[model samples]
Target: MSLPPSYLPAGGPDPDGAAAGKRTYGPDFLTALFQNPLDPGYSDAAARRATEGRRTGWRRGLAGGSSALTLVVIGFLLVVAYRQTVAEEPARTKARDSLIAQVQNRREGTERLRAQADRLGDEVAALRERALGGAAIAELKDLEAATGMAPVRGSGARIRLVDGPTSVDAVTGERRTDGLVKDTDLQLAANALWEAGAEAIMINGQRLTATSRIRQAGEAILVDIRPVASPYELTAIGPDELAEDFRAGYAGPYFETLQGRYGISFEAAEVKDVTLEAATEFKLRSAAPSIAPAPSGSASSSGPGSPAPGSSTEGGR
Candidate 1:
């Protein structure tokens, strides 16, 4: 039998109509969503859960209580941790300040000691020069200059190296280290200079001696355990052809590679009247200068000004 018109879908072709037989359109999306806010699957799952809850009513209540207790415990732990951190902040701050102060004081003390040592060394040298005069003193002075035990002034080549700007990879978020100047680079440059006939060399005023060390400690480069800052300047005393020879040799090309590949800055040129400082002397308590009694009966040449060739001295270390 035919039903009432109200039972049919509104604003669309009748089901018995030919167009309705070909295709059908549902209610508007907003209207449908308002009518059934919950999805069919979610409704089914909720029904199943309700039925299971009814079956195990006591267990469901216990689980809910356990969850609430766990949340409460976690909140309490968070509160306690925040309180502890707040309480310890002052102590941590105080400790950090104390450490900074100590470091500053120690650095100042070290500077004072270094200055005092330099003064004493000058006084000792003067006394020795007065006691021993002539060829022996001259020879000793030559040895001192050769061994980097004393400062010297003359014409030489100056090499300057500077660290490049550090950049991070945009894709990988990794800091690039190749741009920074390394100890090996300094060593290579020094060797290159030496090969080109450099007699004496200094890095940022620190003289390079037989016992001198160039190494890296963490992020800093050190010469003889003393840290040197970036933009290292190397002064090498050598023949007149030193600068030209160095630039024409392997060093020039290698430095160019560094500049192109790593962005490090390099410069080499000849400089006049450049003075370099002496290396820090390491003294031994038991070491002493050996004095030769001058040939057979010869006037016992002055006193011991310096250690005889191949003999040990206080600052041998």
Candidate 2:
């Protein structure tokens, strides 16, 4: 109380006096503390509020960091789940498709057998017109008796056809069988063998008899029960050189032109006659039932008995 107030530094003001003057707070409080530590708690409420604010800031920071970590973990889990799901989807679809196909084929085969049984009389009548009398009828009876006696893989060459699209050249604009093996292709190859005097033919592992038709299923070309694929190799016992020379000149060149685009391999060989048993079932399509005697002067069967010198399905698969 003594003399007058003391002098403060050049940039400083009298701290005690400043506090005593009013309840100064906010930035001013921090300023006052640094200036004079001796000063009393002039802004006690403000001091308490600052302390609480600092604690709340730290707590909020921790909460935000924790939240971010949790989100990251959840995201990681979701990504893993998504990958696993994608990987398993195709396998499951393929398995399901395979099961469905098997079931359908078995059903179709069963139905075909039933139809044959129903039309037995008509089939025999058609056969009579063909060469069904005497020796032919006798052969039929023998064949029927021999059914399921044993599985005999007859002498024949394995003819195969693979997936070759229309024009391998995207620009050629040629007609192709959609990258799927065609019934026509198999038929043609087999026909060539027959023309070359082939006794029998097998496509893939399946035996091709009078009634077998090449069918496309999924990615396969079915010859009866056997499946065949591209750049088909057809074997005939009569002539390796003959078949090669024939196709090399006719279908062979055409095949090379086509394969030049798709890249398939074609080969033919001569072997001993393959011994394949008669097909367990035959599919008769014409109005003429194959087993029936010929309808009085209907002409020789254009059935298995006749081979098309030309004309067959194109192949891709």
Candidate 3:
């Protein structure tokens, strides 16, 4: 049996043809061939498929843009880090060199100014010596000595005080600050030298005047408001027996106590031809002449009836 020709479309396969044989078709092909083109569901399905493809494309584009943005951000951060770590070294080195040069220049300027001041001071001293005679010069010398403005040299003693080695406390397991040298220690040592007939005294090249102050500022010891560090070298100009006198003074026993209790180090030795520099500056607060007043006239030498000098005798009262 053969199917009617009306069942096939134009130019379709002929069932009676010699080339006709048993043939098979896939389900997708048959579905497409028999599909209804005007169905509402088909149109809706096509629109849904198109929308899904567009959404997938949009998601892929968004993901690619985000990845590109992340890569750009990462690259920018790497550049900034490289500049900070590698490129900034030369710039910092240049700035440091500039600062060092400025400091050196300032130091040179200070040195020049100091030299000029010293020359001017010398000239003034020379002029003063020329203006004043021998007696005036002697008086000036005495004044200079009293004011600590003149350097002195003589046989005297040198005392050295140093901070003790750092030690941990056995009881508290804490570092002790008592072994450090302090301002009071320096003051006591200087006072002891003065009492021992020391004519001149210098600590760390700074001369001690009557107005000189030794004090503590935080952890530092300041002499004349200038900081000083250990080991302190105190040079005094006096007689050869100055060291012996100092050894017998209160400072010696105090220092011994400090050594025994706090472990402070101290040493004193007699030195010959010791020189002490004069103080840099001096200020006078009060001064007076040493002359005595004239004696008053005796009352017995004047007559009882005589009027006193510059006195007015009115009537007989």
Candidate 4:
């Protein structure tokens, strides 16, 4: 039998060659494997050999089931990992918002109470003045001035302290908290103002009395237990040279150091009239008359007595 001309090489096959040119591997092998049952040589042996080329139905089913199971397990693991790693941001945000609302509500309530207390104190003072007469009224005025319970207005200085610019160090890549104003800084500033002869000082509009406390609560600066944010505006009523005096005092070198080292901002200016509101009246916890007892045998007469008011020296006469 002769092979087709197309199958032969360019030179054509040898006329009586014992063997054909190396059969170039082609689609014929696959075609033979899948030949129809009606084709020649489709005997049991051919059927068995063709069956070997393809997977059995049971093996195909098992492989498909395994692949599906693997995919399901991978999906489940991915879901678990996502849940474990990613926080529920929405819930956290909601909680944070709720806490802020609560704090605001409490602050509002506190302010309302403070205002009520101030009004009540004013009423009490008015009543006392009406009942006690002019001498008592003058005494009360002096007491108010001494206790910082009277608003004061005079030529003084205004000191402004602000948080410095937030920046990252180029070389170190470290975030600095020094730029943020601290309670200690405020306390020191107030002390400096006092030392500089500040008669009255107020921080962020809160009058500072003898009992006022300036301290830190976490990241907030608290003045008299009230949180005050920067830039803190501290006003003091004193001599016109108060600002200059403060600049000349220890505060000068201290603030300079802060500005140079930590970048804290400090500014002081003289003002014609800076007013500070009265501080809340402090309730006396304990008190007693400060007057000492008169000496024994000393007469309580108004002056060098001619006689006692109701007695006479008739016996001597």
TM-score of 2: 0.39
Prediction 4 global C-alpha lDDT: 0.75
What are the Cα lDDT values of the candidates? Answer: 0.76, 0.57, 0.77, 0.75
Q: Using TM-score as the measure, what is the rank order of every candidate, best first?
A: 3, 1, 4, 2
Q: In model 3, which regions exceed 4 Å deviation?
A: 1-62, 73-109, 165-175, 285-317
Residue 81, candidate 4: C-alpha displacement in angstroms: 35
Please give the clash total of every predicted structure, in order.
0, 45, 0, 0
Per-residue lDDT tens digits for candidate 3, residues 1-317, read 65555444346775576445534443464576678546778888899878765446778899889999999999999999997878889998999999999999999999999999999999998898899977898899877875688977778999999987777999999886778887767776887787788777888988888667777787798878788899988888887899988988887888887787777788999999767778876676897875875568643211111222443222111
lDDT digits (tens) for residues 1-317 of candidate 2: 44222333333455557434433233466787788876456577579768766445778899889999999999999999999999999999999999999999999999999898869967865767476577876676555423322234333444444565445546876555455445555655665666655544444445455656666576566666566666566544344455555465455665565567565445554445455544545554565546866688554422232333433334333
What is the lDDT, from 0 to 100, of the residue 278 in candidate 2?
Answer: 46
Residue 314 lDDT (model 4): 21
Ranking of models by lDDT: 3, 1, 4, 2
- Give the Cα-based TM-score of candidate 1 against the true structure: 0.52
After aligning candidate 4 to the native by TM-score, how far in Å is the CA of 184 from where it should be?
A: 1.5
Clashing pairs in 3: none
| Top model number, TM-score | 3
